[model samples]
Target: MTDLLETLIENREMVQPNHANMLEVAHGGNVMKWMDEVGAMSAMRFSGETCVTAQVNRMDFERPIPVGDTAYITAYVYDAGTSSVKVRLITEREDLRTREREKTTESYFVYVAIDDENRPTTVPKLTVDSETGERLRQDALEGEIDGNSDKS
Candidate 1:
């Protein structure tokens, strides 16, 4: 069984003018595209099978990544279902001049494993053996909190 806690993948891309919007920041759609791709890759690496995006929970853009900067996207599988995997994606913007980075976006995505025939396939249960894995598991659970729920 592959350890899901320590598993991670990082990808970097240079933000270009074409990727920006009228405000001169990376477009929300472009960022979403990057996240989806990275999340799918992480799910495939963990499950060892092809996977497709089933759903994406609220994706919050915390900050804007300006053009000419580098965007670093990292993904990890935090939960696994019978035929689905949940991935956490973090997007950060690295300033080229000052050498600083700021988190620009965060999101949770669920992917369904697929067979060679493109049908849903079952995936192995996730095992977390380290602190990182445990933390990720906890984060996943906490993220399930319904923000819209009314409580006294």
Candidate 2:
């Protein structure tokens, strides 16, 4: 079994000019690339094998990360099949100076574990042993934690 906690991944990137559009906000493509990188890392962490993106669920760009700000990304494996891993990904726009953050985008990705030969391979079952892990899993399933719900 792979603990959900073990699959958690976090990353931050500065929105540079090259990664932004004419409006100075990050381009959706760059943000998506970051999400895919983090999601693949989490899936590989859970499966202990190379993982490839199989599918990406609805990805909505909720806001913008202007240049000079930070893109905060997080990904975790919330579920897995025999050969596929389900990862929840979220991106947040943050002003590093003030430490203010707002959600930018959220998406779910499916990754398939691959063997050395590039063939799909079976992956272990997922487990949530800690309260934090459980809460995160629930948050993924529920879209976002409710304001009234207990948070980890």
Model 2 RMSD, rounded to 1 decimal: 3.3
- Tens-place lDDT per residue, model 2, 43-151, is 9999999999999887878789999999999999998898999998989999999999888888889999999999999999999999999988988877643322222
Model 1 has an lDDT value of: 0.85
lDDT per residue for candidate 1 within 1-152, as digits (tens), equals 77875458899888999999999999999999999999999999999999999998988888899999988998888888889999888889998789798888888899999999999999987888988778766776576455221111
Runs of candidate 2 with Cα error greater than 4 angstroms are 144-152
TM-score of 2: 0.92
**TM-score of each candidate structure, all chains considered together:** 0.91, 0.92
Clash count list over all predictions: 0, 0
Global lDDT of each model? Answer: 0.85, 0.90
Q: In model 1, which regions exceed 4 Å deviation?
A: 146-152
Top candidate on TM-score is 2
lDDT of 1 at 32: 97
